[model samples]
Each structure stands twice: as C-alpha cells, then as structure tokens.
Target: MSASRPLEGKVALVAGASSGIGAGIAEALAAAGADVALVARREAELTKVDAAVSAHGVRTLAYVADLADENVPQRAVDAAEAALGPVDILVNNAALARTGPIHDTAPRHWAQAFRLNLDVPFLLSRAVLPGMRERGYGWVVNISSEGSLLQAEWSAPYSITKRALNALTAQIDLENRHLGVRAVGICPGWVRTDLAQSPASLGVPEDELLSPADIADVVLWVVTRPSTVSVGPIIPVRPVSKSAQTVANWELYLREMRSYDTSGGHLIDLYGETR
Candidate 1:
C-alpha cells in the first residue's frame, strides 16, 4: 500500500491469527506490504482477519488448521506456501494456558497443554525452516509469556511449557544463525485478549491490560530490523512490575492451599511462612 512499507514483496504466515495478538500481528504485517496467510481453527474467524488484511492491499489467504493436531502444522504450512508462495516470515503465536495446582491437574490436561504450547511451535518451525534456509532469508518469531521466567503456582503447565519454548527459541537461533534464518522470542506480560479474560485465566480488565496491537507493533519492529542486527530476545511489560517472581510464588501458594488436605497442613504452613 504505502511506498515506505518495509515488508514489500515479503510473505508471512501467522498461526493463531483468527483473533487477539495473532490477528493484530497479521494485520500489521499486511500493512507493511507482506502477503499473509492466516491460520486458526475456525474458518469464520480466519475470514474476518483475511478481510482486514486484504483491505490493506496485500494478498491474504485464510487457512483453518487446529494446532493441537500433530499433523496440522505441516498441512497448514504447505497450503500457505501454495497460496502466498514461500514463507519469508513466520509468527508462532498460538498457545494454550492451563492454571491449576500440579497435583490437581489431570494427565490429559498436561498433555494437551504440552502439545499446544510447546509441540506446535516446534513442529511448525521444523515444517517451514527448510524452505527458509534454502532461500537464504527468513524470520521466525515465537510469542512467549513472562510466566515462563516465573515460578507461577497453579500454572505449572503454562509456566513450564513457556519456559521450554523460550529455551527452544534460543536453541533455534544458535543452530540457524549462520543459515540466514533468525529466531527470536517475544515475551509479553499480560495482554488483554479473550484468552486472558476466559474463566480459567486471571481476569485482568481490558483497560488495565496490554492491547494485542501493542505487542504486534513490537513484533513488526523486531522482524523488520536489519538482517545484520538480530534481535534474540525482547520482553514487553505493561504497568511494569518490579519483579514477577514473588507474584508467581504467591499465586502458586494460594493454589496449593486450595488443594491442601489435613496431611498437607504442614506444607501449607511452610508456604505461608515463606510468603
């Protein structure tokens, strides 16, 4: 659209792009002149984003694929390539967060969280990396959470998987640094998205939360930076807390108490004393 667009002629694939942060990022990329492929589970939601991206004067394709399904990532990538050409940019923004005491969490829930949060990104990266490496240019941005660096109570699976994802981001960067492919982890603190307001999440009001568009702006800046200057990691915090460790631990303690029994009285007391 605009002559100053940094991403002119580039192609991007944004996973979890039906809404929230993913949609915001997709729209921004399109505005910067990148043809985009929007991926999500719901075709209706993807259509909405596709319409908006197309209005920005960039080619847009809507592909519905459930990231939870192990085989879906490759299929989605293939379809995106067919529609928009080789992916020059990829945003692994799809994720799931489950908050509950480790002992109280069911095995199935843990598996689902791992698959969605950790496995999906890993698989999608693998699917798109080869083509990127061959082209001698590509950008992979992994959307992570601040919870990864904190020991959040009741949110064992969320915190664990995010931490692992961050580690995976670094590993990818190290391995592909010389291949013209770059990876970075974008960790945002509390964004006001539907997922953040869900019954299972900490319901921070929209007014008090970081807007998805805000995070998307940062993503655009990072990916559009000079290829010679690689941005390895970036953290964007809203209402910036001094430290997240204490808050995470306190939340964990309260969660542990909810599942405590008579035998856990001593453990509860210890947690109280520590807090």
Candidate 2:
C-alpha cells in the first residue's frame, strides 16, 4: 500500500455522514483511499456527501435511514458490506443531542437519546466485529462529546448518553482486543458545527471553535495507526483555555466550593489562581 493511500482497498461505514463532523470524516477516509458508505436520515445531504466521497475516486454508497430505529443500524451495515466489501472501519458519529432539564424532557426523548447515541453503536459493532475478527482487523471510532465529561447545564440526556458511549468503547476494546479488533471514543468540544450555535457556546470566539476537518484529522490518525498501538479507549479533544461559557460555569463552581472550605488552605484554592 502507498503511504499516501494507506487505507487503499479498505471500506468505511460512517453513520450521520450527511453533515458536520460525519461528512468531514467520510470525505477524509475516502481521500485516504477507502471506499465509504455514508449513512444518515437526510437524503439530500447524504447525496452531497456521496458525491464528495466519490470524487476521491473511491466507491461510495449513501444509506438513508434514521439510526434511532433499532432495526436500521444492522440493515445499514449489511448494505455497506454487500456494496463495498467488508467494512474495515466503522465510525459511529450519529447522536441525538437533547438539551433540557431531565425532569422536563420527555421520557421518549431520553430513550431516543440512548438508542441513537449508545444502542446504535453497540448494534453496529456487533454486526461488524465477527467479520473483523475473521480478518483479524478493524476499527470502531465512536464520536462522543465534551458534554459527557463536563456535564454542562440542561444537557442531561446528551451528556449521560455520551458518557455511556465512553463506557461502551472501553467495554468493546476490553472484550475484542484478543480478536484483533479495537474501539475508541472521541470526545470533542464545541466544534464549528451547528453545535457551535448552541447556548452552551455563549461567549466563545469563532476562532476558538474547532473545524470539522480538525476532528476528521484526528480520526484519520486513530484508524491509520498500527492496531498494536492501542491509542487508549477514550480520546478527548478540546480547545485550549478559551471556551468561555463552560469555563465561566466552572469558575462559579470553584468560587462557591472555596467559600465552603473556610480554612485559609491550599486545598480550597484553584491551582493557577492567587486567591
């Protein structure tokens, strides 16, 4: 295989590939010489990504289905394998981001959040792992969010579901390592997707937000590395010291906690702060 086209002859199945980070990743993989199967509910957007993937002169298939449907994940994988050979890479980039207090959010929304974010990945992994094991090769790249770690306000369902995805990645890696397959969870902070417009990004400057290509570059790095490297189960990608809104909340929390510690001690103080 050529160094410029290290993924030549491989096939990648990417969910939520219609837009944003998914679209970016599908194109990146194709550019690296991998045939890509793009899965998403939006036919129009999916068509656009398919064209882009095809432009790389690699085979491309666009599967239009809502991953929240329990049956759709398997069918998507089945269609991909039939059309482009066995999938060497599976990217679970689909997610349902529900923002609201847990008490106010409907139970159905919570269920959907779990089904799309967590269950879909599990189902897809189950479908592809056996074939990957037989070939002794594969990569499962899960797109979790920074919300999973920060547990930001009014983001219970999103954060909890993504947190579970991290756990799922750890479990999949632990169970499948012997078979020569691996899994990793990618936790990205406010990137320049539609997510950048959310209230959570109140004071963030435009330049501070990561581009979709930024995340895609990381995915390429992850999957292209030797399987023996074990890049760890969770990879957290975030902006450097400039996420305004979330940091503000953290500052508030730290200030309050310091108040409770009445002792004029180092334990109560934030590491970099003079107070």
Candidate 3:
C-alpha cells in the first residue's frame, strides 16, 4: 500500500462513470491511489474519464456497457477483475430516470428504470460478494436519489426503483456485516448534474443543489473508515441550503435555465465546503 494514499492497492469499479457523480467518484478513488474501472454506455466519454484516472498514476480500464443488460453486470465485474484483480470497492452509480406519473409511464420505461436503478445494482453486488467474502473485505456503495425517501411527483419509476435499491442496501448490509463486507446507499437531494437539469426537476434552487464531488467525498469517507466501523444502510445527503422540489411546468424550467449561470462560480469548492 502507498503510505500517502489510504486506498493504495485497492481496485474500484464505478458504474455510470462517464460523467456526473460516477466520474467524480472515479477521480476521487484514483487520487486516493486506487486503480479504477470506468463503466458506462458511452465509449468516448468513458475514454475521457479513463484518461483522468490514468493521470493519478493508477491503472484504469474503460468498459462501455449498458447497466440494463442482464449479462453486463457480471461481465463487467469479470473483466475488471481479470485485468485489475478482484474489486475491493463497487460503486453502483448508474441509474435511469423516466419522468411521468405512474399511470402515464409506459411498461417498457418502467422496466428500464428498474433494471438500471435497482436490478443492475443487485447484479453487481451479487457478483462481487463472493470475492469479497473470500477476501473478507469489500465496500459497496449504491447511489440512490432523494426520490428514494421523498415523494418526488411525476417520477414514479425513478422513485419506486430507488426505494427498492434502498431495501437492497439494507439487506446486503444485514446479511454481510459479520463477514467484513459493508453495503450502503446514499440518497442525495437535488444535485447539480446534467441528468438532474431535466424539465421534471425545474425550480430547484441553485444554492441547495449538491455538487457531484460532494457525494464522492462522502463515499470516500465511508469506505476509508476503520475496519471496526461499518457505515450502512442509508445516508441521506441534503445540501446546506434548502431547494424547491420539481417545477410546476416546462415553461418554468426553461425560464429558470435561462437565468441560471453556471460559468461564473465554481460549483464545487473542494477545500472550503464541508460535507
């Protein structure tokens, strides 16, 4: 292990790592001296993240696979382990959010959301547990959303699947706690990411939105704790300031977007902010 980085020699596989929260987490893990496997559907974007991960002098493997695919979870895990050894940490950050009322949401969209948000996490977690049990060590972090806890209207598919993901996190922790494997779910409130800037999420105050790196920092902190400490099963992440929920309409969202200027200020102040 590298004396300077607590995660030295560790291997982290981050799903949805092409951008947003997954990308942030991947960078953080690499900086902490962990080799990383970046997974997502976009090969070009994953390649970019791979470059950033490589800059930290740790190994990096970019795997372009949609998490919704039934075979992808185990395939990605197998490939990462083959190249970088067994994964010491698994970050289930991939998710799909299809906006609509429960009644209006199509069956296919609902299934897609569930597959990506809930089933993918389950599959990846299942794949890594055996290796983790044998090694007697591993960390699994599931990236849930505020919808998991809060009643976010017009997003029943997302909310329902994330709620299921929360249950999975708890069950995994309960079953594996005694075996040196810990699983935790992070429910982040309005976050400043491209995905969160959708028409459904309008009117969310800019001040209250969390940066992706904020969640990344929390993930790192959770995994770096003493062996005796097991952080699980859910961590609710709200920003310091309060924000409005979903917008009233698309016009409102468009108006807010027009007024929002992200270029002037840093969304994440790494040194000054407290988690």
* Best-matching candidate per lDDT: 2
Residue range 151-220, candidate 3, lDDT tens digits: 4335467777888999999999998879999999998876778876752355455665688999999998
> What does candidate 2's lDDT look like per residue over 33-127, in tens digits?
99999999999989998998999999999999998885898899999999999999999999887656566779998999989999999999999
Q: Pick the candidate with the highest TM-score.
A: 2
Write one digit per residue (lDDT tens) for candidate 1, span 6-56: 898999999999999999999999999999999998888889889999998
If scored against the real structure, what TM-score would every candidate get? Answer: 0.85, 0.87, 0.86
Name the candidate, 2 or 3, with the larger TM-score value. 2
**What ranking emerges by TM-score with the best candidate at the front?**
2, 3, 1
CA lDDT, every model vs. true structure = 0.79, 0.82, 0.82
Candidate 3 regions exceeding 4 Å error are 198-207, 244-275
lDDT of 2: 0.82
Q: Where is the poorest 10-residue window by lDDT in model 1? A: 262-271
